[model samples]
Target: MLDLQNIRSQFPILNQQVNGKPLVYLDNAATSQKPISVLNVWEKYYKEINANVHRGIHTLSQLATAEMELSRQKIQKFINAKHDYEVIFTKGTTEGINLIAYALGNSNWVKKDDEIIISYLEHHSNIVPWQMLCERTGAKLRVIPMDENGILQIDILDEWLSEKTKIVSVNQVSNALGVINPIEEIIKKVRKNSDAYILIDGAQSVVHFEIDVQKMDCDFFVFSGHKIYAPMGTGIFYGKSEILEKLQPFHGGGEMISVCTFDKTTYAGLPFKFEAGTPNVGGNIAMGAAVDFMNSIGISNIQKHEDELLAYGQKKLLEIEGLKIYAEKAKRTGVISFNLEGIGIASDVGMILDKLGIAVRTGHHCTQPIMDYFKIAGTVRASFAVYNTFDEIDVLVEGVKKAQRMLG
Candidate 1:
């Protein structure tokens, strides 16, 4: 019942040729290509509803405002937030985490000498904000160790978490190793010991799963728009209703305040209190359209299709001589991280793959701690999506074979 060919047709970018060969875009963990519907929304906004939202009294202003709020509602249902106000528009996942960190840093919940815990598999976006918070507030940064397979050591978290722990921030799925973490169990355990807030970096997981922040009961969650087939310069930050209401405002400018009198001005309500200045109205509107497109296709079918692709890719890549696949666990995402034997280095292998027109990511994946643990610079990553097909994976495997031969 899942029409993959028809679905692929909706994405025009996937049909293009790259480097005189068909583009095998496997760098989905980096970002996803947008669909035609998403692009059209961008054009339609500027063409018809070009005006500042929530301020102008004209017809264009009303239309723009309506469309903007419609995006908020769409995101609300996407993540199943308790209220639309709980969802705040941010620049991306990085900004979202920073907003929560800064807001909590100023709150009485966290104090000097307190501990904010993170795991080794976190991206720099999740790590650095807490590190900076620790420096400013005298809070100590605690790291949860990962196992040899790159999965979070959930058993060790019981010992790591204590009364001193103020927050426990981690990724739901590792961008580098494609390991989907046991976040629900971790959250339930953390709650029994301390009132530490939990933030899930869903930049990778959101694309592959139907996220329900309310069901998960996480204190805060963040993800990027571009990762979920939306445009750049757009992202979402979800905080619990009570949690968001108590946090201090991070940015201050024109639209955030209710009435400015130079003498103790009162800030606007929940969402506007956090969203300052003019937002990317067009990008956010497009994000809503992107959500509509995905809903029409259904996320369950997408996940099923991707799971098959991942299994096929893993099985085929193992057949290649002198190649080692990382994260050989059953519960992994669509990303396949591996290294070619006899290749000088991952970078060299990546260069060869590039020459063969196979696009993939080769680096630390913004996860330096994990690389240090593995004692390797990085691995070559080929991540898949709904638009990707088995034929493309075959092309990628052949390209890797070619790279191995040339490099050896």
Candidate 2:
């Protein structure tokens, strides 16, 4: 029995109007709106407990360190990771993937001629790392193709999984087309086909669905905090204990070193080994608050509400003449990437939407590879969050209709 009206009131930014019209934030795929709870925690930390963590004996230091660890525990519970140390904080998904790629590539596990498989629907963050790793090592990169509907070709993936494939990284959900990948089933199948390690890009999935790394049994899972209603410059990279122990450290600096001598140096353990330099203390702590906020409201509630919004948006948008929505899969998220007929440029349409106080993302969304596969320039994307409502969709529907007439 979650109260949607009460929840909407927690976001202060939603109260204002933009461009002389009611603000309609539909670009949630880029980043979500922050609630008061998240902002309050950040403000409290800066005002009260602003101190470096895990170093000093001062009371402020202790308080900051405790808060930081509490955040880790919260994240551990959020994704159901067995150990808190498995969650390593980084900048965002881009950094998370790069860390994995470099760490695994430098190890003996991923060697020359070893194949790393990624899907065609992958963002540039996922694709380029493997490409760089392949270039550095003599490892080969394999791509699993997608159908016209933007669904991954399971038959093709089955054929691609072989003994030489050492790593398989795929998005838990496609950001470009709103396609919810069958990651659990795909991971299970990958295990049977080969002993390859799997990493799931959970950027879009974490915000929209319930996630359990233990149940998913993925070797690594990565996501950004910004997309989950937390501050920017914070992300999580969760590696299985056994797998984490095998990979080399990705970065080296202050907190990550255990001992440094003239002869040799030793590294720290688990998460500290990955977190280098001064971590984003405020952003990391705020991420915990974000999880707390989502959990308090219930992830199931968020999913159900978002699904309802998506359905309402789709039905409403269909009423518009010559509008096309991508993907009709049973499993999907709240993202809608579309194009209106006779619209010369997606960018212009996006500008018009902005003029109407409707925020939407345009362009390839950093998945230019997918755009190249489909032979389309880009799409105008409108993704929803839990706070979104049917009324917002009506505003967007009217906005699109107006754009259609104006562009024509």
Candidate 3:
């Protein structure tokens, strides 16, 4: 377990007041608050070495490029990607998925009669890109159905996998319900049964778990830096080296090309081929710092501490009359998505709680299909982080109860 007070102290934003009460932030699943360590490195990068990467003869440019490449290496080591060239920087999970759709799908790999499988738990980022790919390739889209309790119906794996399956992309964890999907088993099954390549969306994962792409044997893994307590507009796109070489460049531009002419062009090697133009140099450096900071505290410690809090918080939430936590029976992370009785809209409850300085996310959470499946408009999601405390959970419970009375 982590030291709650000390961990909370590392985040300067947590020490402030909101609406006459101390702030209790529980919207971590949307985006995490950065610690002073991450903030410090982020600021330091711009202040000390502000330069465009990879093309200058100046000292700052060289330093910036070096740092950016080092960040790639750090991500490679962090995720256990086989090579530094496999880690390509992108804007975030959305862009990462789009990159794969264009780069891999357009290579004629996913043709007519091919199939792409995603699940009901995907964020729209994971869903929309594949939809576009299917439209482009004439490939059919398949979905892995889940039970009412939100556990994936992996028992029906054989029903989905076949020789026609070309690419299977899925989330490692559900951002809306916090249900951890069994991606490793899915990958192994797909590998044995079909030639389908797999992509695991780690946007809501990586932050909570230690992942080794090599061990998981997935062909691709995409994640957002902001969800992992790094800056927005920063992300990592990891692909298998062999598969990456087969993919066409997602965009055409300067840095990604090795030789350029009006008639024909040759692209750069593994990652740079996909990384097209000027990249997020400073943000990538800061992302590396975020990875280092998480390592210092340890992911296992954070996960275990949050698991304890989840159990306590869920128990407390269930005590409220007519309150329901989605996916309660499923093994999950530190997220609790719930709706209270007599609350006409989830946002009404959220706003009332916000007045008491309890911050929670209230929406479909970019997983509208899952919301539709549950027959709800939305939910009030309380997502915990390492700095959150049992005391804070108590305050959240009381504030939510107050919101219930006011709304009722």
Candidate 4:
């Protein structure tokens, strides 16, 4: 069991007050609060040994390189990747997905008539890249539809999956609704039906549970660091060795190339080939610290605690009259998206909550399609993290009730 007080204490940001009341931070899905351990790692990197990695023989460079590589290995083991080389440092999940799409577009892999599949649950980051890919390659974009309850209609894949499908991308957990997608079943269906590349967007899911890229059998997996209590601008792109070897480099600069002659330039090996230019060495090291922090508490323990919070939050929030929770019936992580019946505008409710020292996300959440499906502009979203408490949920519940009373 996790010591809630001890865990909460580690995040100094949670202790402060907002709008004259104790802060109730429920906007974790946008970005998580960094713990002191991760912040210290970031400071130590700059204070002790800060230098460009793999390019210098100096002591500082060597030390920085070692620390960054150690971080890579930690992420590798954290996600259970087959090899460290399969893990490439990226700016975030958006860039990683763009890299894959661009590489595939440049290669002969995706043809003019090929189809790329995504679902309604995808973020704009996942949707726009494939749309751009389709424009570049003359490929068709297909979508796996979701039901009224925001559950993905996986059975539709039987008709969608065919020889023409070249790529299938889906999120393991919906960022907007917090619904846990049946990606294992989706992967199985994709493998049995078509010879297509599969990419799982794990930006939200990685924080809430254990991720095994090898066992998951995805060709590529990507996630952002800020969503998982690490520093911003740090992310991971995990791809199978053989698939990574096949794709050409996405960016061209210093570190990605072995020899740069005027006439010919040979690109570097697996991970570096994709990493191009200088990386976020300090942030990456801090990300490793974040991983260590998660391990210290244990992912399963964190999951259990968050699950309890979700259940409690849902039960309490539903007690509010005219409150409708999206994806309430679906299995979810620690997120709740809902709107009060008479409120009409979600931002108004968000503003009311903000004045009460509660932070929640409003608007389409970069998921306009979902909003369109529900025939609403957006929903007020409250996402959780390990440091969050049951009392905080009570605060949120009361805050929502206040918003409803004021608006409705």
Best by lDDT: 4
Note the Cα lDDT for every prediction shown: 0.89, 0.90, 0.91, 0.95
Query: Candidate 4 has which clashing residue pairs, if any?
Result: none
Give stretches of model 3 more than 4 Å off.
Answer: none
Considering only N, C-alpha and C atoms within 3 Å, which residue pairs clash in candidate 1? none
1-408, model 1: which lDDT tens digit per residue?
678789889998877787788788899999999999999999899998889988999999999999999999999999999999999999899999999999998776778899999988899999999999998989999888887887777888788789999999999999988899899999998998888999999999988879999899899999999998999999999998888888888888889898889678788998999999999999999999989988988999888888899999999999998888877773799799998765636988887777767789998889888888877888999998878999999999999888887778
User: Which scores higher on lDDT, 1 or 4?
Assistant: 4
Candidate 1 overall lDDT versus native: 0.89
Model 2, span 1-408: residue lDDT tens: 558689889999988888988788999999999999999999999999999999999999999999999999999999999999999999999999999999987777788898999998899999999999999999999888888788888777678788999999999988988899888778988999999999999999999989999999999999999999999999999999889987889988789889978798898998898998899998899999999999998999999999888888888898888998877543678798888888858888899999989999999999998788767789899999988888898989998998888997
Q: Model 4: residues >4 Å from true position, as ranges? A: none
Could you give the C-alpha RMSD of every candidate to the true structure, in order shown? Answer: 1.1, 1.1, 1.0, 0.7
Candidate 4 least-lDDT 10 residues: 399-408
Error of 4 at 70 (Å): 0.1
Name the 10 consecutive residues with the lowest summed lDDT in model 2: 325-334
